[model samples]
Target: MARSATTIRRSTLTVPVAPLGPENPLPPLLPRDDPHRIDPRQRATLPPDMARQVGYAPLTSVLPTRLRDGYGRDRVPTDLDTIVLENDRLSVTVLPAYGGRVYAMRHKPTGRDLLYTNPVIQPADFALNGAWFSGGIEWNIGATGHTTLSCAPLHAAVLDGPGGAPMLRLWEWERLRDLPFQVDLWLPEGSDFLYAGVRLRNPHDGTVPVYWWSNIAVPETRHGRVLVPADEGWHFGYEHSLTRIPFPEWRGADRSYPLHGDFPADYFYEVPAGSRKWIAAVDRDGDGLVQTSTATLRGRKLFVWGAGPGGRRWQRWLTEDGAPGYAEIQAGLARTQLEHVPLAAGGEVSWVECYGPMDADPTVVHGPDWAAARAHAEKRLAATLPEATVDAAYLAWLPLADRDPDDVLHTGSGWGALEVARGGYALPGTPYDPATLGPDQRPWLTLLDTGRFPEEEAAPERPPGPSLVGGPWRERLECAPGGPLTDYHLGVAQWHAGDRAQARRSWERSLSAAPSPWTARCLALAEAWGGHPQRAIAVSLAAAKRALATQGVDPVALAALARDMIPVLLDAGRADIARRVFDRLPQDVRARGRFRLLDARILLALGDREGARAVFDAGFEVADLREGDEILSTTWALLTDDPLPAAYEFRMRPA
Candidate 1:
């Protein structure tokens, strides 16, 4: 592992991209917004500080970050902007426009891909903003789960790196916490490792809760084994519980292998203090990817989708036919992703990460004795890329962290530009150029400068636009001239800040000003999350009716609303009204897979089992199916004793 010559070049990666169709016009909301959110069962087992961080800055709302759930299943060949960093032994391709992900890392000597290069780009209902695809080395920042920037772009530039090689730096203003973060990646000459230096900075005047996870997806196989330093881990699943579990083997089976179990779960390795942090996924042949980071990223994890039908279905859904399954080996700032550590005012945390190939003895790694297996892998890691080298690389990259961009490689969201204009920040390395601001930020820019939200000429399809939930924006809205649009946006900002009572009042006043669907839906969400299900049902129904009555309304917007509201009615046993809502939908709108699925629920509620079964027999595909969604299987089971078809068999549990 000696330094040699390196190369950096800009290129395009053309793949079949299931185009992210559009931003859902509706502001996304949840049934409940839990502040200080963590599993109650975990309190006794966790350290107080880690428990506190888990509840810290629980993302109450995703206002400014609009939902990107509008992607479809159809894919077309698309060219994504990419930056290729090559050395004598390694080649790394980073997608500048797509969440600054390392799309592929090839070990030139073996001609191997060290990370899961998802054969296709298929967005699904994952990320905090709803559209997340599975693959690559994804830099997850903001709150827990996938970052809002998963499918979004990042500002990219080139700067001097180690050995005077060109470094690719991606930075942007993360809107949720109103923070700035940057990722600097480079290949040091002939070294096989790809080094990435990540920095998350809190620019605010007060403490802000921050989360960062470097998620690296590797190909999963029956013979694959994940090696981590820890002998114990915190296991979490869709069951909403976290429990202490021994490493490698859980219960009887060795959960280290992806196929050992049949349900998706997370095993967050409890790496002992002073241990060198690293995780690897090695196959039977002992050829695999290894990710190790400097001390700041103390947590390592193994996320498996498992061998269940749901997991398999999702695996195929995200990639092309015949592509292998993938599992994520992640490194983070906390023991588990459920926590968000607090970053002090004007404070910053930076660390370097190394990703490349590792060679191990397959027998010991896949052995029955967990301790020996783990120790053998650790020894190999220590020899391959010593802990000292990772630390040294981090230290060397620190001084060059703030070097201004010498060449702008790609443009990202204008939200950063707007933030720059508001704070007059002198962010050197990641310049938020004013010229990047576009129509999306124009209204907010107007609100910031003039304390007035620019309104469009009245139109049915023009619901209240996207929201700005920053404290400063909320204060500006509270002072702005009150109108339906202004008050509605103000309520959204308040809700995001965990001020439910104030948000409710603002929306009420907005609804009184103009009984619009947008304002009504916000108020209903407040009611639901406040434990007033009956009131919520009524308010949501009213909102749906209001939208239905409005002319020139975008059909897509109306469909999104019904898709959200009908479930509430059905959950409350008000299927009669839910049926009314469905009957009112335009034929084409009701024909979408999501609605047709809802239609089956209505039929089942009406005691028409045959009708429900017939709907399934007709065949359809839900493009935005969630990660653990088993509703199709549940509905199918309810319909009859017949086996659920392959297309509809996404049941992760043993039903």
Candidate 2:
């Protein structure tokens, strides 16, 4: 047997990355704007204890993290910074610059990639920040949706581990929850499994909501089966509700098979406590990947895009025409991704997760008897890597969790440094280095050092910079002298804290001082939420007018504003106004795929069905089309009375 010690090395991964264009220059107008997400339905079905924690420490806004929807289909070869940890049996590739994603894991014995490795970097509107790519194992740590860190970087460093071995640590301060978390990865010589010790800590004086999920994507196979130690699971479908469904076979289809269903869905398995907590996606030969973790990580799930046309189209759109489809088998702290667990002040939770290939007897593993199949998996897992080993790994890592990172590999966002600067936090293994602070954090740092929020003119050409929605920032903004920038940002922080009335007042003051479009957009959102539709409409129109008045404005910025404004107008039955907004754009901008989508929408509303159909006939593609966005097919249905085009069909749920 080979005796190569666990080693960490700097590496480069060359893949095709569709460039993520500049962020929308507009501050998010909606107070809790989340048009890209699906709200979990049927809360009444949740038990009493589970219901109490669903909205724990919920985020009122995704402030500071701007949307990244400005990407196109064009791809170019790019080399990304990566950290690789390898031993005799396994080699793991981590992309520190891209959300610390475990980009690839090659099992040496089988010579196979355990996780679905995306062939290219294709940005889609699936994450909280508006851009995400499929494949690899991604650590989701912020909220119920795809994390704001999906495309963001993380601080990485090499650290000494047990017995002179080396471990790779990825750490970051999650801005939304205002908490710090870290993941340590290492592999032992001759061992088949890779180990990850994760911890999330809240240093504040009050409780905060925390959500974590290790999402592992595997190839979707016709004969693949996902097994969990549960008899019944909660099924969440786009039908807008959660229904109780039994495991293995549900509704005459084997739910464990990733391709058995007809629509995209989530099965939150009811893993009874004290049972061996594990999940695996295995082929017909009963050889594939298996994941097991310590007791703190209780939830197990299987997410699949079923065999439906929309599902098939989405599978193709995310990668390429002939790329194989994949499904996600995930584990989280709670029973489902829909809920968050609360961590008290000065409290933290830590656990260890293990991943490796599961090789079991095909007959028993894929047999109809559920208990026998589960027994086979658990038995093999215990023999291969016992829960005791995982527990010991967690215990050993706890003592070393506070050690300073020995060798800095890559630098992430400076938000952590700003947090540490404000609170004097003593986070250890995850150093929030002050050196990482860049232009974005300078304004906030000034507010912390000096006693005032810096002043800046609110104009379309120079929109508001990054926002800090933490409580301390809000308090400082309150005490600072009134100014357009100060008060406008204060309103956003206040709104994120759920103080709607006070937030509106702050915005009102900002608008009174400077009639800027960004502030007007916020005021419009407030009116819309307050049931004042007419007032909302008036403010929205003013925002558009203010935006259009600026000279030498960025076209991409204008496109974002128009995209958001047109939808609001159309939704409110003001397509004439929507048309007005669309017609004002430059001809080249209008010809862009995303705008052309709006063009078709507006044409349909004006009873020009032929024109709307003509837009589709011209064959334009929505470059940043969101996941599950059915507008193209719906518009086609309403206008042409013809079969939906294959290019436009991206429905993820059943008809």
Candidate 3:
């Protein structure tokens, strides 16, 4: 009997799991008299109506839960409990435990994994909110960066599509934003490609930005090359300057080629005009993987850590020694992950993406020569079998006598699966009972209050306090002395309390520990507010330079710091220094509405009234000038020696 091109089977394999490691202890839960607390005046600045609408809360009221170590010594599972979907061309393994990640995908013909797989399941403090792991195809939805649900398990079920074709369905709730989404993954019979359909739903009345990115990691080697159909790309760095550069060539080297030097590079590329809808990575041997999605998915990104010492250090931190360092080929729903589109209340958006293997000629070294690879991809895409139409009505079917309560299985209409142990799954139209389900099938409600859940409720409720002068925030900081997050929060409290010196110290200490552009920006702001303009300029400039030179720093944070520095430097009567910093900024940053006014001011101060007017005129066409339009208009009028635009606005303080 001949084997089918694609088949779905449930099986288990013993996989290594690391024990929970040491806990990072939290501070006390009581408020105390301290300078590092939010001031009454600052608290009053928050509009009551706005706060009520957004469910705003204070930092002091939120108590930290006991930390659990997710990374410890490794141990393998005794049971084999995994689902495998494969075709003659490729194989995919799905793990329900690791947030339903596509644990491994292999190109069967070459016996190599199309996606990188960690040797052991080791969770670490890598997530922006904490608890993340490397490798595999991670589905990020809702907020930007890694989704809070990245480390949690998801509701999963196996279902049959039209004509009884096998499919796996995984769904989870975006608790923070009150959004729900589902991903259906299928490998059609006799097909070489695996397809994913993502459906996102917003049920609330308030509009919110929707962010989704599929992060795929692959083995990084000198011979590996990432190929995107785009001819040119937009690159944003730590300084948050969005520079347009020719594709493949960034800085000096061809970035499409795998990491060869000693630094990390992160580049987000927009879809080029008339480009095909796919991105791929091919090795020196010409064996590679390709991912294609609908035109709705607009962004392609490449993240690589070169073979330098810094890159190697990060490699060791992310994985065990000897484990291969990998690069990521990510796809985003917008032009960049930082840019999100609005999802209107009660709205829905969905799209489909396909993944498979491609064989290319080893001799194709450059972008121009990638025609062979593209042709190979086109053939595979053209050969993709049509998916059977899935029936939606069968999703509510009752369990069969022999079926495990936790096992998600296909019904004729839809899928039948157990609810997650932690309660967040509110199936839009489908309802289920928690009391009738077993422990594994029941919702885990306790996790919600413990801050382990990703919902907004995990944040602390507002506590009644005029200021942190007699608040619990001080005790919390005392308890968690070395935590960078704690220190940053403490600095915020100090800044609001009019203790600028202490705030500067706290921010500096936080930066020393975590080295984030965010903390550095805060420190610069503290210095400027504390009447030290020179120190503020120095701090902001140093931070910006460091961010530009270093890898792994968030470009958004860097951009904010650089943008804020212009106003601070100009206020300090140092337009020359401001111009220097502004010149280093990416063209996109300079083109911002706020920066246009600053640019005109700098030119005006340099005795170039005509240049300033030209910039202001250009700003009207290109910038989204909002709050400071009147200020810019007045500056322009004064530059032209026209009649004063308005009475001089001034404030006076008693002597």
Provide TM-scores for the models.
0.94, 0.96, 0.56
Q: Return the top candidate by TM-score.
A: 2
lDDT by residue for model 2 over 98-214, one digit each (tens)?
A: 799999999987898999999998988888767889999999998877888888889898888755579888999898788999998888767899888899999999988899999
Ranking by lDDT: 1, 2, 3
Whole-model Cα lDDT per candidate?
0.84, 0.84, 0.57
lDDT of 2: 0.84
Residue 443's C-alpha lDDT in candidate 1? 85
Each candidate: RMSD: 2.6, 2.1, 18.2
lDDT of 1 by residue, 287-357 (tens): 89888999899999988888887778878888889999899999999999999998998889999999888
Cα shift from native, residue 272, model 1 (Å): 1.6
> Clashes in candidate 1: how many?
0
Per-residue lDDT of 269 in model 3: 75
Error of 3 at 469 (Å): 24
Q: Could you give candidate 3's per-residue lDDT for residues 1-655 as a string of tens digits?
A: 5757556677786766654443222211222112112334433443353223222322232122212222433445545356788867678887765556787898766787888887766565444334567788888875545665666556667666433566677776554344567777777665567777777777555676677889888888777888777657765432223455786665787768757545555577757645556778888887777787766676788877666544565565456668887898898776555555678877777767777776766665333554454555445444543212211212211111112223463211111122233324445422233433443211123222332211222111111111122123444443443545556656665664556677678778867766655566667766776688988787777766665555554443445556666777887888888788888777866766556767888888888889987875553421112111235446756687664322221101000
Better of 2 and 3 by TM-score: 2
Ranking of models by TM-score? 2, 1, 3
